[model samples]
Target: MLIRLKELRLERGYSMTQAARKIFSHPDTYNRYEKGIREIPLDCLITLAKLYDCSLDYLAGVSDQPRKYGR
Candidate 1:
């Protein structure tokens, strides 16, 4: 889960600040979510899903198998 989020951020060349802005969240809060210091809320997850163009299952580490959204 941590690795995947970091991977996605790096793959997109997004700094924490930039990603936070894009997701309408504060950088510190987002950092906590990434660091597992705090549980990510469902709404936050949904925001990240849209921002990263990924499925919720992937972010939640529910599955590695990829599935495109709206398929």
Candidate 2:
């Protein structure tokens, strides 16, 4: 889960600031979340799931599958 966000962002060629903008977050805040220094909000997680085209379960680390719920 910690790796997923960075992985997805890099795969999409998004810098931290650019990824932050996608979720309406500050770059520092996003970095904190990425580094596990802060707990990410549910809304932000939902936004990231959508942005990465992945499922919350995957981000939550309970699943390895990255597929979204409804394609």
Provide TM-scores for the models.
0.88, 0.94
- Candidate 2 at residue 9, lDDT? 93
Best by TM-score: 2
Off by over 4 Å in 1: 69-71
**1-71: candidate 2 lDDT, tens digit per residue:** 88988999999999999999999999999999999999999999999999999999999898888997676
The number of the candidate with the highest lDDT is: 2
RMSD of 1: 1.5
The TM-score measured for candidate 2 stands at 0.94
For every candidate, C-alpha RMSD to the true structure in Å? 1.5, 0.9
Summarize candidate 1's per-residue lDDT along 1-71 as a digit string, tens digits: 77788788988999999998998889998898889898888998888878888888898888784354666
Residue pairs in collision within model 1: none
C-alpha lDDT of candidate 2 relative to the true structure: 0.94
